[model samples]
Target: MTGKSLSERIGDLGRRLAVEAHTAWLAARDPRVAWFARLLAVAVAAYALSPIDLIPDFIPVLGWIDDLVILPLGLLAVRRLIAAPLWSELHALAETASERPSSRAGMILILLIWAALLAIVYWAVRTSPLH
Candidate 1:
């Protein structure tokens, strides 16, 4: 059995993931990294920062599509596309910035929720027997 407690293990995992994601962001700007790998990295970084989700989070079960499925997949792809040495170099220099690097999430979530409610209301009114 691994000696570390669950919380410690989780924290370690979180730090490692953070380091990998940060590496992708930094690697995107590095000329040494191949252009296509850089492009993929840039897309992953932009997606992680972008609040305009492909699937709205208000939906049941599927709301977390971007977070649970898309981002992880993108990260995995980035990890795959980048070379082992580059990843190793970047991982060693890891700095998981504490602050969120974007400003759009809260506003976007509010807007999406409002839009969903409005659509529901409109649908109800259009289908009502009282009409």
Candidate 2:
């Protein structure tokens, strides 16, 4: 292994992930990317930025697994779908961009989704025979 400490490596990985997510965000907005790839890119970027997860972080092992595995895999798939030259261009742009973008719209969408799910659960419980 390299001489760098574990914390240094972790820091580097975090930075790389940040750049990759930013690149995916850029690809999502670019018309040059295929429709399917753009859709996937948007999903990956939203999930990366959103506070909610498919699995709650309180769950043992599995919750952290999604963050560690699913995200990087999704980013990798987006990278593969994009042409090499285009991907490189986007990566460079992402690294150089002054401001890392935040998605208020994505946050709102996530909140709406959670609200709907909560409402459904409440309705179900209220209507249940055991209630």
Candidate 3:
């Protein structure tokens, strides 16, 4: 059999990578994906922050290899599980998440809700007490 040209091989690789990325993006939307995602996210975080490296950053051209390669590869692996159609749905979910509240405002709203709930509980407890 004849060998494939470089361009054809590259195209095939690109298609495979794209499919993997889309699959990963789809998987990210499912609650079932949480366990594996969390584990991968944790590992990625550790790799980013860890002192160890395949090519230490002090070595100039080689130093950033981990940053350029490992992180992207890990992310791609995660993306491979994501489904393509769910991407739009996830975008909508992301927009809703962002529009709801900034973190500070969300925290304040949660505190206020908890205070109101506590007040109701207190009233119920006091009003119903035989003591």
> Could you estimate the TM-score for every candidate?
0.58, 0.69, 0.37
Candidate number achieving the greatest lDDT relative to the actual structure: 2
Candidate 2 yields a Cα-based lDDT of: 0.94
- What's the TM for model 3? 0.37
Per-residue lDDT of candidate 3, residues 1-131 (tens digit): 69999999968765544444343444444675567774664565456456888888899978976667886688655545445455446545544543564688889999999999999999988899674
Q: Per-residue lDDT of 52-118 in model 2, one digit per residue for the tens?
A: 9999899999998998999999999999999999999999999988366879999999999999999
C-alpha lDDT of residue 87 in model 3: 45
Candidate 3 off by > 4 Å: 1-30, 49-52, 85-131
Ranking by lDDT: 2, 1, 3
| Candidate 1 wrongly placed segments (more than 4 Å) | 1-17, 96-131
Over the stretch 7-98, how does candidate 1's per-residue lDDT look in tens digits? 99868866666666777888898888889999999988787767778888798778776667788788889878888898777656656353
Clashes of 3: 12
lDDT, each prediction: 0.80, 0.94, 0.62
Steric clash pairs (candidate 1): none
